[model samples]
Structure formats: C-alpha cells, structure tokens
Target: MKTPTSPIVAPVALLTSAVLLTSAALLTACSSMGGTSQKFDQASVPESVRVPAGHKVAWETTGRGLITYECRDKANAPGMVEWVFVGPQADLWDRAGRKVGTYYGPPATWEAMDGSKVTATQLAVAPAGEGNLPYQLVKANPAMGSGAMQGVTYIQRVALKGGVAPAMACTMAGKGQRQTVGYQADYIFWKS
Candidate 1:
C-alpha cells in the first residue's frame, strides 16, 4: 500500500534539485567572467608576427611568463637597468598545455626544451600594456639547440603585459640581488 506522503515527497525533491542545479550554473558563470583570459583580445595580436611581402607565418607561440631582473649596477651609468640580471625566463606552452620550450632573453633568445635554442635581435619596437615591455619585431640568428627553432628567420615579442624594469634604481650597493617580475606576451616565429 502506498503512503499518502510518497507522491508529495517526490515532487518536493525534484523542485529542490532543480533549484540547486540552477544556482551551481550561475556561480560557474560568474567565476569564469573573473578570469584574466577575458581581457585578452585576439585583434590586439602584435604586428611583429607579420612577415615581409612574400613570407608567411612559420609558427606562433602564445604564453605567459615572468620578466626576471637581477639587481645590477653597471659602472653606475646614468639611467640603465641597474637591477638587470639575466634576461627574463618564460616557459612557453603549446595549445595542448604542454611546455614545449622556453623564451628567455635580454640578448633575446628562445630554447625548445626538447633541445634547440635561437637568439634574436630587436628590429623594431612599439609600446604594449601598462607595465609591460614594448612590442618588438626581431630577426633570429641560426638555431643552436638542434630542436624546433632551426632555420627561424624572424621573431617578434609583442602584446607584452608586465616585464618592466625594476622599480627601485639599482645601485652598486644593490648589485647581485635578483628580482623577478610577472609578464605575459606573444612570441611569433617566422621562417624564410
């Protein structure tokens, strides 16, 4: 024999479940909206990726990284990056979220973790985000690492966000101390 309350219990349980599901969805949506990826604009992709009249894009790498600076004071020069250490080191990840290589430079270089590296020279520059370095067009030297970067003709660093020179002026007193700042940018690789 069915209890008088069984039918009522079923309906109430269904309604409660519906309410909980709706609330969970709303929270998920809100959390996604707060992410940094929301601020990224594809249209703002740096022109450093563009090649000469006939060339095309060989490959492109997009990733976030730290703009590392070590405390440095060279001869107490006028207004140099006194807190400069090795060029920044940024881990470059592929679309699959796998770390395939690293972009580290001041001399501006890229190294594939698998075993290849290339150095690039800045050819042109334009400003990017508030605290970031300038968007730069560069030309890469031959690849030394024997990996993916071989035969890379041109390289560009652009859409940078946060790789600024150190805030405090580096002095002889502060020499040898290291500092790392957070930064993100797009690295474009072009071949001849």
Candidate 2:
C-alpha cells in the first residue's frame, strides 16, 4: 500500500548532504592548525582592549609561554574540582627575537626587562577553540614595575596556540596535582 520512493530524490538528497558536509569541513579548516594564522584587528578587539577615542597601539610583543592549570576545589583544597586556569608565565620577545618582556596572568602582568610592569584584570573572554585556550580582554594599568608597561591603557591576549587543560581525571584524593601546558600568544598594549 506504500508508494515507492523516487530514485531521483535519493540522489538529490545525497548530493545536498555532501555539499553541506564540505562547507563545514572548510570552516573547520579555516580555524584549524596549519590552516590559518591569527592576526590582530584593532576594530574587533574586545571592549576592554579597545582603545579610547584617541589612543593608539603604543607597543606590542609576541611571547612564547605556558598556561598553568591547577586542579583544586573551590576552597583551595587539593582535589580535582575543575581545571582552573591559573594564568600564563611567558617570556616576551620582540620581532627581531630579542627578549623584551614577560607575561604573567590571573593577576595579569606584563613586565619589561628594565623593570617596568603593567597589570590588568580580564574584562571579557573568547574561546579560541574547544581544544585551545580562551583569549582574554583586560584593562591594564601601571603597577610596580617601570619602562614599557608604565602607562599602558589596556592589554589583549590573542592568537592562542595550545594551553588547554588535560583530559586526565583528577580524583578527590589527587588534591595537589598541577598541570602546565605549553602555549604561545601575542599581547598588545595600548597607550596614549
């Protein structure tokens, strides 16, 4: 009593499915490693990192660093509650490969070799990807340190590579376990 399906309909459906899949694959490829690299766009920066009416990018540096994750509960007890991102401790370098500064986060700071440092608190966040670390937008201000970071207005973390916490399970008994993953990013400093 059921009508037979049309042979032409099946082929059209298959072709449509293939095209959709192909489009998805292309999008994923654009965001994947060895596919595309990240670049800074001033207009698109997070609100916290966006410069005020007149200020411009005063300085920028590229850094090679590691993001540290601690497996601790809410009360600082040494068991796996969640993979809390402690922050990054990285060595900053210039375009010519010269060591320029260092970045430390969670109490986010950028310190230059001459002892100038700026610290900021995150105001916004963006996920770089599921497997990669999240990018942050911070409001930076002068801290104890001197030179490069003294008068900074903001700091933006972008172009994240690696740094996600491991999938390893942490039990309640495994309280003090700490994991550090390698990552690299570019930090842009805005100043008037």
Candidate 3:
C-alpha cells in the first residue's frame, strides 16, 4: 500500500530521532559532572610560576614538594571530551599517547603537535572518589580542533612536575569569563 519512499522516510525519521535522543543523553551525562560544589585544598606554588590564559592553574603541597593542577575550558563538542597534556614524558601524556582506548560515548583521538594522530591507551580521569570527572560543555571546529579553530570553548587538562607547565597558545572563540573546571587531586613529589 505504501510507496518505497514512504517506508524509507519512516526509517529516516526514526534514525533522526534516535540520533537526537542519543545526543541529549550524552549531554546530560557530561553535565552532571560539571559542578561548582567540588573543592580541593590549596597547593603551594612558587611565586614565580605563571598561570596561562584559559588555564585555571593551581598547586597544592603534600609532604615534601607539591603537585600542580592546570585545566583549560571544556571542549564539549557533540561527541566527546579532549585534553592536551604538555609536560614530562613519563606521565599521562606519554602513556596515553601510545595506545588506542575507547570511551562509552565515542572513540577518542589524540593528536601530536606535528599533525600526527596518536592513540590514547589509558584514559584515566581524576576526582578520585567514585564519580566521573566534572566536565563542562564547549564547542570547536571538528576538523581543525581547539588550537586551530575559532568560535568554540575547548576544555583541556595537563599534568606537570615541579615547575614545568603546558603550552598556553590555543585559539579560543568566546567572550565569557572563564571558570574553574573542577576539583582535582595531584601527587606531590620532591626533586632529588
């Protein structure tokens, strides 16, 4: 009774609805993590350490030395969250860049500064209790990315030892005041 196009249209409509529903669900999940109630004890940072723009940089003391926290705005495209780690070679960056890992929502891709895409083996998030990392919503050019695109709020986080810090050169496309991404826990280590 129905034409071929009629049946096709029904499936197409159903698919479209499904995509919308999935996107909404993912967004809800990411939003639940972004809250201001979370807090962390202050870390001792040297007076000479400079915090970069878009970077909510902070540090705290443990016992001997200290560990630092640096978080950029959230890069909440329709798909997933991405972070840029720039510091020592043995930390999360080097370990994660070598393997391909999958998340619940989408497949994550890590790219190097030279345009080569690296595989992230271990994607470990902080907020070390029993919950997901607090994530804010942001947007950016999908093809170009945070450092290359305009008109998007891309979030990022990096780990640093001692005084070494990540690069602070990324193109941000928004006029809103930046806020602290979330609470974090860092392991402090002393230089030998």
Index of the highest-lDDT prediction: 2
Where does candidate 3 stray beyond 4 Å?
1-5, 33-55, 58-192
TM-score of each: 0.64, 0.69, 0.23
Worst 10 residues of 3 by lDDT: 96-105
lDDT string, candidate 3, 1-192, tens digits: 964676588899999999999999988866564432233322333222222235331211111121222344546654332233322222221121222211111233323333432222222333312332321112212423333112222323322223222233322442132222222223221111
- Each candidate: how many clashes? 6, 7, 6
What local lDDT does model 3 show for residue 187?
25
User: What is candidate 3's TM-score against the reference?
Assistant: 0.23
Predicted structure 1: lDDT: 0.71
Q: Point out where model 1 deviates above 4 Å.
A: 1-50, 74-82, 169-173
Better by lDDT, candidate 3 or 2: 2
- Which pairs of residues clash in candidate 3, taking residues 3 or more apart in a chain or in different chains? 43-59, 43-60, 73-155, 74-155, 75-155, 99-121
Candidate with the larger TM-score of 2 and 3: 2
Q: Order the candidates by TM-score, highest first — what do you get? A: 2, 1, 3
- Candidate 2 pairs with clashing backbones: 78-175, 79-175, 115-146, 116-145, 116-146, 116-147, 117-145
Highest TM-score model number: 2
